[model samples]
Target: MLRDRLLQMLPEDDAAAESVEGLALTVTDLAPGDLGSWLADRAGQELGLDVAGRALQGGGDAWAVAIADESGTSVALDLATIDDADLEALGAWLADPAAPIAVHDAKTASHALHGRGLTLAGVAVDTLLAAYLCHPDQRTYDLGDLTVRYLQRELPTGVDAESDGMLDLGLDGDHSGARTAAARAVAVRELAEPLRTDLASRGATALMAQVELPVLATLVGMERAGIAADVAYVEGLAGEFDAAVERAALGAYEAIGHEVNLGSPKQLQEVLFVELDMPKTRRTKTGWTTDADALADLFARTEHPFLGNLLAHREAIRLRQTVEGLLKSVAPDGRIHTTFQQTVAATGRLSSTDPNLQNIPIRTAEGYRIREGFVVGEGYEGLLTADYSQIEMRIMAHLSRDEGLIDAFRSGEDLHRYVGSRVFHVEPAEVTSAMRAKIKAMSYGLAYGLSAFGLSKQLGISAGEAKGLMDDYFDRFGGVRDYLTGVVDEARGEGWTSTILGRRRYLPDLTSDNRQRREMAERMALNAPIQGSAADVVKVAMIGVTGELERRGLASRLLLQVHDELVLEVAPGEREEVTDLVRTQMGAAAALEVPLDVSVGFGRSWRDAGH
Candidate 1:
């Protein structure tokens, strides 16, 4: 209205009015290179305002720029839609070092702009990152949502903005776009302090500043330098798995004396109980259980060939599915670019999707073969797989302050073997294989709130025997048993559990009257702090390793993080330094009663690296 009214005050041939530009800038997404550098220089100064193409879209998805300091906002342009000359003009204005650029999430936008050859410098704060610090649990930290959430102000957005108490400009129109962008840029700048202050209030400033932010930079590099996949090898593995699937299917049919769908539960039920007249294992909602565990139990009792074939069939088909999934997700560059979802898991663990590199099986021989397909890329020397050895156990020992458990780790003997000896009343060197296996299972399982009954089922032993083993084990390591029980009790009393780093997981159901609900929450409460602390330690280690690599100017790239492991692609001649750095950084991620032990392996393929 102001511009139109002023235009009406001038004569039709008024020279000044004729040349004046209406929202004199084209709005576009932030792209890297010369234009990106230009925009980076202009962040945070009063500028001619128009549209904020980047701000309106979302920081991680786009870029923001200031026109002229009419309050550090201008017409934002989508680099995609704007004419070349208009873009160049916008670039020229942004080249001024005085203009300020604000982004929503530096992980997405900064890394993207870096890919385009423009590294963001100067006054920049990712408000999305700010919102994360404020409320780490909220997954989507979009601009419009955060503005309304933090500032009680809604930016102009959505398909129909006129319906809400927002700027009533059409979403597609330049005027509306400019309003949305301006509102967001201002919000990004304005929202930072309140969020930061909130972080300070919660005592989360160090977690955000020292841990998450630096780790995010590492994650960006990992996401971009995705692990290379051997396409031909993957295809060949799929073929082998296909043949195995067929053979397993044929064997099941022959063993049953007739063809049946091994994948179908109903068909398996008919063949197992009705046709073969086998004894029932367990009852389910539909019928007698033909589930994997139940079938395995039945096979153990009767040595049923059909059951064995069925299990084999299931395993083969699963391998094929994994291979097919990988083949489908392979990008044009021959790498599997798994998107690491940083904020998905409540325990602060990272999740991988679009091939889910984390879930790739590693227990079976075929699984090891599947890993062989993860090979080094052209520019990297080889892959390095480094992992913390029994990190969670060390954390358990530290948190429990259990003398015997600490001795087991500090003694430098085989941990499980030594533990088995104590429970079996034998010397560490005299621990039998079976005793060590059960001890190992109990050692890891107890930390996760595993009960005697559950452990019995897992080990295929009588529940009474399992109970005796647990009782004996706890007698030897009484501190661990006491600590496990105390964690649940504390959570029930306080309504939450805190990790060693002070991250909290609130377990509201710990106070519930319902026994089932209460028990589940108890297990979670008991498990959360230990697991969450390990997660914190790994994240800190990631940041340290990444920062040190950059500081030392090494060419090796951290590719994937699989729970307790870090997979790096080493460059030529940097393997020794990189390996030592990873071990040191990971080991120093946290201070525990016992040492943080790390195991490092490297080879041409992920399989070899594991060895």
Candidate 2:
């Protein structure tokens, strides 16, 4: 059909007229009439145009007339402008079930024709989408890469626009229809296998077909459904934070001999470790430890006015900085749309970028003040915060099937007290405050690659004493010890580890040449299963919660996910219902040996949401 159309456009006087691989014709280009005649004359001579539909579609430009032969490639003419009737005709041809049309520069064409209410002749097949389905994590998406890998040759560029912004093919007497047809044929034929292989390899062909691809149709819908933000509330918080920073700076300057850089960890380390001579606890690459825990430890040992004041100063400054960053990052519509990075963490945990929602302040009293900045907008009643309670521990219990651990959660007992009582060889009621405190530290530390030496540094105790405490802990919870060791050993053998959801993370560096790299990889191997599994559970929960909200036609929107917590922006009257929905959906996302528990709270401000 394409060949017939090209042949019909040619001059009747053309001699030695023969179709070479379909549409390419050879006729003397002695004279020309209009654009159409010129194209027809060129088509007969240099333009080895392919009559085959596949060949025509491969050029990536719908209106381009390509000329190619066995020697090499060239373009005869490219139509920069075409009327509606011509476009419609092209579309009609492409829409035929048996006919295929190829177009390059679809993105630009879409934009250019948008104002005229015009669209391409046929539906554009996204090569980028095909490539992504093949390798979801590959970083680049160049057409050149696709062309080389699939077609095994380079396509012509700089044809649509010249340096002088005029239509010029730079023909160089090499333009032929055969070359054009060959290039197009190659692209169309080569694409199918890569697309199929990619879809199969990532286990994402179904996900793409069933979920991700379809969901993109809803992306514009969601953008249009942007959540409201309290502009006044945000601005008020920024003003308050600015005031707090000034006060904290004053306090810090008075505590130290003179004013110093409060934000500089190097300066703080010098003042705390060298000047104060506050028990050289641990050595960092820079010299002495200046981490948050180290600072807290230093404060405890000295009980010095300056150390306490400096710690307070650090907390206040950090809170102020976080608030300031948030204020700066708010979008024009007043809401903060933090970007979720799905693959940054090896364990398949999503990280927040742009404005990091994950690291929002929570623990310290000063940090808690920053929460007050996040308030309900005008049509919204308040914010609802829902968090999983001791989720990681519950997961550990389930995975390890430790009877004592499972019993601890099942009996509705305080986990730290249960652990403390077991470790201290005492009744739960008799577990001292001091014992519970130590157990709390150990519980969290264990998940973070803490060793006896690390624990000793954290607890300000002798390494031997720390080792004894750890041994007692393991003795009281033998299953946990066995589970941790078993996971590490299993991961070491497999060269990778996976979460409960089958999200695999390779750790080839576990056998690295560098000791530090290997040791770090070992920690990751031990930690990935626990952390990653928890991450997977939360992701499934978020997706489920989002779906349920949509199904119920609720007004509440999931605004942010901070590690283990979900922050929801609720409609004025839907707080109670929304809170229940969030807790229920999140808790039911997954089940392990131990039950999932969730805690819910609401407030006009983030601070009020916390108990």
Q: Which ten residues in a row have the lowest lDDT in candidate 2?
A: 49-58
What does the lDDT read for residue 495 in candidate 2? 77
Q: What are the per-residue Cα lDDT tens digits for candidate 1 across 1-611?
A: 32343234335653322322322133333222434443445545533322232221123234333233233333444444445555555545433444454455555543544433444433234566556656655778777787788878665443233233123232342344344444445566666667778777767677776777667768768877888999999999999999999999898888877898777888888888989999987888998888778888888988978889898889999999999999988776788777776666767778888769998889998877999999999988999999999988999999999999999999998999989999999998889899999999999998788999999988989999999999999899999989999999998888778788777677888988999998988888888888889999999999888888989999998999998999999999999999999999999999899999999999999999995
The predictions' CA RMSDs to the true structure, in order, are: 6.5, 10.3
TM-score of 1: 0.82
Per-model TM-score on C-alpha atoms: 0.82, 0.67
lDDT tens digits by residue: candidate 2, 1-611: 33454456445453312322323322222122233333333332222221221111123233333333223222233333444444444334333433232333233333223223433333223344456444434545455577777656664332323222223222433324333433443343345456657556645455434333323222222232333445666667667766766777777677767877877878877776677677886787878766667777777777777766566666666666787778776666566655554425556565776577678777867666667766666677888788888877887888878888899999888999998888999999999898888898988887767899989877778999999999999997899888888877887798777677655566788788999998888788878888878876776777777788889998877766666777777887787788888888898889788788899888887678766
Error of 2 at 606 (Å): 2.4
Worst 10 residues of 1 by lDDT: 49-58
Q: Which candidate number maximizes lDDT? A: 1
Error of 2 at 472 (Å): 1.7
Give the Cα lDDT of each candidate: 0.73, 0.60
**What's the residue-level lDDT of 118 in candidate 1?**
41
411: Cα error in model 2, Å: 1.6
